[model samples]
Target: MTRITSERHTDILNGYKSGGSRFNEWSREMLGDFTLLKWGWGALSMRWDIDDRFIMPDGVMFGGHIASVADHVAGLVAMTVLTDSKERFRTSRLETNYFRPLTAPVAMIEAKVTNASKTLIHVEADFVNGDEKLAVRINAVQVRRMTG
Candidate 1:
């Protein structure tokens, strides 16, 4: 279990250059102003500064934004189990449950790979608010693929 620092994350991103500009940009947007707090074997923790743009008119974070963060982080956790440079994972199914409204200025996200097989990987993510309450939970399955 190795801690993934910000520099390590940058190295990993640079090592995996398969994703084109579109994918990279999308990931960046989903993880806006995020800090990698810690990471080990198949688990990672991150903190995201919630932007005012993501807040809805009712003053709560939008559900879609939450879902996107889960999906992106889940994929990153799945990548931790990859054994080959050609291996890639894509979310095939994602289910998100909102337990409470997210009005916090920041979000703490934790993602871990629960199970994995030759072709599929299961991941779970939790989004916690500033009050340390669970705001959202996400379960996802990622399909593994090989690239030439």
Candidate 2:
């Protein structure tokens, strides 16, 4: 299977530009169909409709899913920002904090790059619902892959 992790920056950036509209068919499949809400030079917002599979037994969204959303969306932002540099990246670290229960049926994620260097990049995200209630905060570090 062709994984998003293995794809080039141009392909991933194009996928993000179309925002779940089949610009990059692999990204739509890999992300399980995330809807692109917004995009800029170094940032992006995406959303996912909460389903029963994303809910925990306590009737809240699963924390792992929240983290995955942040990571995947943030990674896309990083890749888009670095597309011109011909660089690939991998998440070196990821952290998420839950502020309250995610009761909404949809998750709106906004991610942006905090800083970047030749070797490392930092990104953060706010996971909110339709009403703008904060559900989680995510911080991630991406390391540029040095390819021969």
Candidate 3:
């Protein structure tokens, strides 16, 4: 596999950040670190604050937020390898497994692109709280529009 070069990837990431409204909005209002920390053509890593709005009444990060984060990460990962720039992939499926209670005040999510093809891409992620693993996930058979 060809590794993504830092300089070239940075360019793509800078462009991607401008369009990352779904996460930026959430980060600003909820996580407070809307500033993107890392990105490339095919991957991104981000952190969000565990503020009260994001936390459950039980003092854990809410499932809804975790799921949304997963969706964003997975979708973006799939988009990175697309051969078509004019079209976006649509999520055909997504599933998140809450392994342990995410009771910690802060959650960190890491998403990766597992496979990519002309028509399908698969992505996954894990949500961590300090040393604890809160979730393991696989999502979205993002289908690329085929062009002849």
Candidate 4:
């Protein structure tokens, strides 16, 4: 694991702030239209426009798609704590629980880092439907690594 200095952490966080809408091509392809609502030291919030493509034949958003979005947002929150560009993290454990079916065309995802260490980060995210009801919850553990 790479040691993250306080200065380095601040720099990385500032970079994220300046670089708005950090979604890459892969993220766009996977999740479609989304807006980064807020970002901080160990938290991230986003709003996504759920289209018909993500809906199941039963008229609810697919569970896998919700999980994917949760994973992506959790990863972004974890990256804010990284000190080095060479340092990377992978989701070692990801658990998602669906509280209710998502029938709305919009979703609000909020992810926050519960705990972070040199080697691991624990994050939790909530998926809320347009009705402001909890639709799904995700808990994830990301393992950090240093690469040359």
Candidate 5:
């Protein structure tokens, strides 16, 4: 397995901060992050403020946003692992479970690559609120896009 270099990690973080990439722009526009805490090998973490757009009718965060974050972070981790610039990753499946309503002003997402193969990458992400309460659990499978 190839290891992720520090420069690549920096590029990934900068991509997110600057919204230089299409994925980064979409994620930032949808998920609102105040800080990207970590971008290590096969792992990414972020602290985000609750976007009012993500609020549900009940006045709490929508479950769909949590799922989106999990999937998006998985793709970001896959991007870090990719070697060629032409290569890309897409989510094949995503499963999310909501344990509690997230009403906090801020939340954290910790995403890690659990397993990776030539064709598929498995990832898991957890969403926790400011009080350390587990709000959502996310699992995803990312597939490497085939190219000619």
Candidate 6:
């Protein structure tokens, strides 16, 4: 199976224009300073600068930040399909593989729902900078609990 590249799924921009302001505001509220770069269908993307507020001694984006992006994107994907039905889930597993180091001050992360099922959803996400894939993440199971 061919993996989806970062640029293809999530495009980094100098800013947002096409309703990006609304997305930005919503994402900021949902995820603090971590801005929403873009989102569509079952896909969501974000960015966070390696500023003083979030920097490690070894350098690179914090693991928490990466995880946050994963959760945000996955939640957004769930929201996409969540209509009148009230669906809830307690994520059982979330995993990631850091492929490259981010030397850039800022890094962009994106997540996508590869498969959506009745009881479980499969998701894969990635963090990248410029043209390099920094991290790869996957959420195996999203057990949709019935809310009666």
lDDT of each: 0.78, 0.72, 0.62, 0.79, 0.74, 0.57
Instruction: Give me the candidate number with maximum TM-score.
Output: 4
Instruction: Quote each prediction's TM-score.
Output: 0.82, 0.78, 0.71, 0.84, 0.83, 0.64
On lDDT, the leading prediction is: 4
On residues 1-148, what C-alpha lDDT tens digit does candidate 4 reach at each position?
4444346445544554454434444566777566667777778888888888788988998888888888887888888777776778999999999999887588888889999988999999998999999989999999999988
For model 5, give the 10-residue run with minimal summed lDDT.
1-10
Candidate 5, 17-107: lDDT as tens digits: 5546665556667776546666777787888788777888787887777776777677776666666555667889999889988764898
lDDT of 2 by residue, 69-130 (tens): 67787687777567444467899999999998775477788888898776888998888876
TM-score for predicted model 4 compared with the true structure: 0.84
Give the candidate order by descending lDDT. 4, 1, 5, 2, 3, 6
Clashing pairs in 3: 31-49
Q: In terms of TM-score, which candidate is stronger, 2 or 6? A: 2
Kindly give the stretch of ten consecutive residues in candidate 4 with the minimal lDDT sum: 16-25
Report how far off residue 48 is in candidate 2 (Å).
1.7
Q: Which stretches of candidate 2 lie over 4 Å from their true place?
A: 1-10, 16-33
Q: Where in model 1 is the C-alpha error above 4 Å?
A: 1-10, 13-31
Where does candidate 6 have its weakest 10-residue lDDT segment? 8-17
lDDT of 1 by residue, 1-148 (tens): 3333345344574433443445455655754556667666678888878888789888899898888878888887887777666777789999999999887489888899998788999999999998999999999999999888
lDDT of 2 at 16: 61
As for TM-score, the candidate ahead, 3 or 5, is 5
What lDDT would candidate 5 get against the real structure? 0.74
Q: Candidate 3 regions off by >4 Å?
A: 1-12, 15-23, 26-35, 132-134, 146-148
